[model samples]
Target: MLRHVLEVLDFLDSPTADGPGTIGILERFLGDLDPSTSELRPLLETQRVVGDRGGTDFVTVTVPGRRGRMADGEAPTLGIIGRLGGIGARPEVVGFVSDGDGAAAALAAAASLLRMWRRGDRLEGDVIVSTHVCPDAPTLAHDPVPFMDSPVDVATMNWYEVRPEMDAVISIDTTKGNHLINHRGIALSPPVKQGYILPLPDDLLRIQEIVTGGPAVTFPLTTQDITPYGNGLRHINSILQPATATDAPVVGLAITSAAVVPGSASGASHEVDIALAARLAVEVAKEFGAGTAVLYDAEEFAKVNDLYGSLAHLQTLDGARDESVLDSMEVN
Candidate 1:
């Protein structure tokens, strides 16, 4: 995983990094797997979409498990989303920025999984990894530090990255632009289902402990953070954006820093930290797909909803009647 992380970082830490270039790197990595295992090769797909600011390349890699849906099996599919504004700020920042850590970690996890599959260490369910590549994304002003704004908006990102086939999602993002989490490695957010932020499951905690070789560290999430973008509210970042677009339970895997670091700041990515997050994601995918890990207690969630009514309204725009208005709203 560390090797893949370093490889991805080296590729993304360039002014020429773009979506097609990223796809090519991943293709070469997965293509190197033994040909005898070609029957289980992961599916790779990429698309280029233009927006007002610019365009980005959305890439998705589907690593089919032995019992995954793609293989006509019933095991659940896990989605690993690399949520980020861009890899490079280009003219503003000449190399890969801290914001690109999410993409690095995610793509690395995908590469490792493919290699594992080829080595006969396949998981029980499928894993879909998705993220976009934009080398020259714009930067946005914020309180503690500047943010790396996407060429496109959160809605467009969700539409391209979040898939219906994902039974659960692990949204990885570089959350270093704030003072909220004063830790250096990675931190996990509470499991979010629909509009409710459920308690973190013990299974995930164990996995974090195993991956980090230390006590589990978690970050806090506010109601505003989980809400959809363009709702006239301050969000911690785009870490939880995937939750607004899907009913499936989603947990944010944040790459953090001891001090606030601007998203567009180059030379801020830590390979060891990114590798740790990637390894955690890979372990979660393994247990979750094997039915050994649970994102949330469905029965407890239902009980809470029964007593307190629905918070699904929080998933929509404030004063908007439904989610249909999402696409119409302009995201800042």
Candidate 2:
């Protein structure tokens, strides 16, 4: 298990960290550990301490309440905390206490186990059942560069409750190549609308074309879906919180293009550059390793719309416009 942990850490550092080969290597390494051996626990504890000292977050589970929000009047105590340490006659059994729909309760138990086994923040209410294990996920305690953010179940994990949107939700977007117009909206050019919600090979091909100059090239794209885990969307919302740019004096725009060459035939390609939308498109594909759309104004969208089509064609387009001109735009 120690070697397995070290391998996981190393893979995480690699450019293609979570590739299939890396996963196979990890599985094989973990297989070497004897489940029957009693040495595993102490080694894990030692590693946990070492990781913590080396600036790695160690996983710990704390169930402050079994039912309802902790701040609410009906919060219940988590009955089993030390059982996971294998301290008693029946040490393998980690305790669980949940009060909710049967599914939610079961999910909470799993979440509690995950928290105990992995380093993460406490959830607020009972466990949100939808989140699944993400081995290389970024800890909430330390934000990483290149912004490796993904949605996870957020309910019952206490800190998630700080945001009103973290109550219960599911992560809808799988293709990590997405941009936010603001918080909840995504921009889509016409070509992307065809398969926005429906997964299509053509749609993926479009993303590939823009990414590589010719066609889709085989590369790594981390894919995880916690829809089966409870409160999925809430978890995603927490993970995808907008970056606060204190130094930038830039305006946001929503733009769409239908006849664009080599981009997802269906899916939003959120764009954000007026002067160099095309160049930015290439930069986005190359730098972030994702296809991107250029942001545009209402008039620009309309002009593009007049040239190609109308914004009304897009089903998920959030019609958000920067009504204030560049001069009138104020940054506080």
Candidate 3:
């Protein structure tokens, strides 16, 4: 996993890095593993989309499991979304910024999974990994540090990265700009369902402990963080943005730091830290596909919903006036 993470970081930490080039690296990596058979080869797709700010390339890699829906089986699917504003705040920031950790970790996990499948270690369910590549994204000013802004809006990102086929999602992002989580390696957010923040699943904690060889570290989530991006409220980051678009239980895999680091700051990415998060994602994907891991307690969720009614309204832009309201926010 560390080797793959370093390889991905080498390619991403360049000014010429783009969607097609990054996809080429992944294809080459997978192709080198076993050039003979195409039986369990993952499906890789990339598309370039332009927006008012600029353009970005959305990449999605699907690693099918033995009993996955793609193979006419009943096993559930897991989605790993590398959520980030952009990979590089180029022209302003020289190389790959700290925010690019999500993309690097996600791509590395996909690479690792593909290698595992080719080596005959097939999982039981399908895994979909999605993220974008932008070498020249814009930057925005914030309180403690500046953020790497996206070429597109949050809605555009969710539309492309979040898939309806994902039964459960692990949204990975760099969450080091805040004072709340002071950990240095990685941390997990509690499972968030339709609108309620469910208790942290014990299965995930066990997985985290095994992956890091340390006690599980979790961050707290406010109702505002789970809400949509354009709702005129401050969010920790885009880690939970996928939750707003899907009813599936969503948890955040945060690559954290003990200090407040600006997302737009270059030379802040830690390879080992990013690899740790990637390993965690891979382990979760393995268990989730086999139905051995649970994202949330369905019985508890139902009971709470029955008692408190639906809080799904928190997932929407109820108070905002219209689409133009999104422009008012700084957009982390």
Candidate 4:
């Protein structure tokens, strides 16, 4: 599993390859949750820009939020949103556009849009584009190892903010507020401890092999899989020592269990209920070639509470939003 995952990640991080193909593999690996039945509707949106000869294509998804819920028809309830985007190419187009940062931003916005939908929320305005540029590819970059240093999991929520552009893409009737979920942006580099520089170049590869292989791999990560003190604060602080001084960024990782389900106790729903916290930990760990799996507790929850109101008030929808509306209206 580690090897397979590494193969995909290596391609994604590679300067030579645009990130789309890698994302396709990820979508395939994760499998598709039903649009209507599962909590993963807006999880992976495939886009295609058609031209005369050949066009461009790519896939994108949003980052999980803090303590995310993975129930269907839901988005992350984390208040803020995060996105991950990538560009791909074809044999015809040699150097296609690589809008990794753009892709990430879109994903974030998509998550937010979804969230707004569940709340019956409306966006403040039309969709807007925020620009970002990728850090130039590492010059003397070597094959980096991939591992799950910690076991991270995922959580998700419903309710996203759908912008005008996404509405154009899906051809949905935006006027009616059918799809309200959208993501914001992504935090590119996570703060985490960097492991010792391996003695041999192959050492990194070995780590990648073990982590990508999953539990069967013989590596320290599985045996050491557990959330660190401070929920990873100490580890992040430790790893960032070298990078912090020179403005270098330290990438840390953690893992947990997560799943996407449909519906919740709060009457929220999602097409893709991704467990963001755990997923972020796992992805960051994989970037560093660590080993670990975040375990998650999956259970359905939705309980209604008692409601007390006058019979007349109960009949009018306005009373729900403003209780005074009930007092002002006279019974027929």
lDDT of 4 by residue, 1-332 (tens): 22332343234333354335534544543454445763323354444332222222333453332223333222212211221112222221222122222233233334344344344443222222111112221111111211111111110000112221221111000010011112211111222111111111232234334434431111121111112222332121111122211111222221111221111011111111222222332332222211121111111001111132212221122333223322322221
Candidate 4 minimal-lDDT segment of 10 residues: 150-159
Q: Higher TM-score: candidate 2 or 3?
A: 3
Candidate 1 Cα errors over 4 Å, as ranges: 32-40, 318-332
Q: Show the colliding residue pairs in model 3.
A: none
lDDT of 1 at 113: 88
- State residue 259's C-alpha deviation in candidate 3, in Å: 0.6
TM-score per prediction, in order, is 0.94, 0.18, 0.94, 0.24
- Residue-by-residue lDDT tens digits, candidate 3, 60-170: 999999999888899899999999998898798899999999999999999998888767889999999999989899998777888889988887788779899999999
Preferred candidate (TM-score higher): 2 or 4: 4
User: Which stretches of model 3 miss by more than 4 angstroms?
Assistant: 32-40, 319-332
Better of 3 and 4 by TM-score: 3
Deviation in angstroms for 40 in model 1? 4.4
* Global CA lDDT computed for model 1: 0.89
The TM-score between candidate 1 and the true structure equals 0.94
**Model 4, residue 207: what's the lDDT?**
38
Per-model C-alpha lDDT, please? 0.89, 0.23, 0.89, 0.24
Cα-based RMSD of the predictions, in order?
A: 2.8, 22.0, 3.4, 21.7
Candidates 2 and 4 compared: the better one by lDDT is 4
Residue 137 deviation, candidate 4, in Å? Answer: 2.4
